[model samples]
Target: MDSPSTPRWRKSSHSNGDGGSCVEVDDANPGHVRDSKDPNGPSLAFAPSAWNAFVSAVRDGEFSGI
Candidate 1:
C-alpha cells in the first residue's frame, strides 16, 4: 500500500449535501476511507476485493437493517 499522502481523497457521492454524517474515499487507493468531518484523522483501509464486496452488499441492501 502507498503512503496516506499519495491517496487523493474525495467525498462519497452518497453523502448528503447537508451537515449529515459523511465519508471520504480514495478511489485511486481502492479501500481508503476517512471521515469527512476529520480529514486529518485516522483512515481505515481494506483489501480491494473486500471493499468491492462491501460496496456490492450495500448496493444490494444486504445491510439495510443496519
Candidate 2:
C-alpha cells in the first residue's frame, strides 16, 4: 500500500496518444487528482461520491451537450 504522500498514480487510458492530454489519478487517495504534466503543481480534491458521480457522468455521456 502506498503512503498518503506518495499515493500510486496511474495515467488515464482515455488520454490522447500523442501525449497532448495527460491526466493521472491516485487510487490510494480516492478523489485526489492532479495533472501529469505538473506533478509538483496544485491538486484537486473531491469527495469520493462526487468523484464517482463525475466519472459516471462522463462515461454515460451526460455532458454531451454539443
Candidate 3:
C-alpha cells in the first residue's frame, strides 16, 4: 500500500468523461473515496467489509431510486 496521503486514485468506470459529476477511489486503500471535482476536499473511508457491501448494493440496484 502507498502512503494514505498520496494514494493512487481511479475514477469509477461509470463516470461521465466530460468533467461531469464523479468520484475517485484510491487503489492503494480500497475504501478511501473523494470527489473528483474536489480533490483537496475531505474524503470518506470505510471498513473493507462495509465498502464491499456498498459495492454489492450498487450492483444489485439497491440505490436506484434513492
Candidate that scores best on lDDT: 3
TM per candidate: 0.80, 0.78, 0.77
**Predicted structure with the largest TM-score when compared to the true one:** 1
Two-way lDDT contest, 2 vs 3, winner:
3
- Local distance difference test, each candidate: 0.87, 0.83, 0.88
Instruction: For residues 1-66, write the lDDT of model 2, one tens digit per residue.
Output: 444666788888767778777888888887888889998898888887999999999899998783
Task: Report RMSD (Å) for each prediction in the order shown.
Answer: 2.1, 3.3, 2.8
Q: Clashes per prediction?
A: 0, 0, 0
- In candidate 3, what are the lDDT values of residues 1-66, reduced to their tens digit? 544665889998867889886989999888999899998899999988999999999999998897
Give the poorly placed runs of model 2, Cα more than 4 Å off.
1-5, 64-66
Q: After superposition, how far is residue 30 of candidate 2 from its true place, in Å?
A: 1.4
lDDT for 24 in candidate 3 is 94
Worst 10 residues of 1 by lDDT: 1-10
- What is the Cα root-mean-square deviation between model 1 and the actual structure? 2.1
Sort the candidates on TM-score, descending order. 1, 2, 3
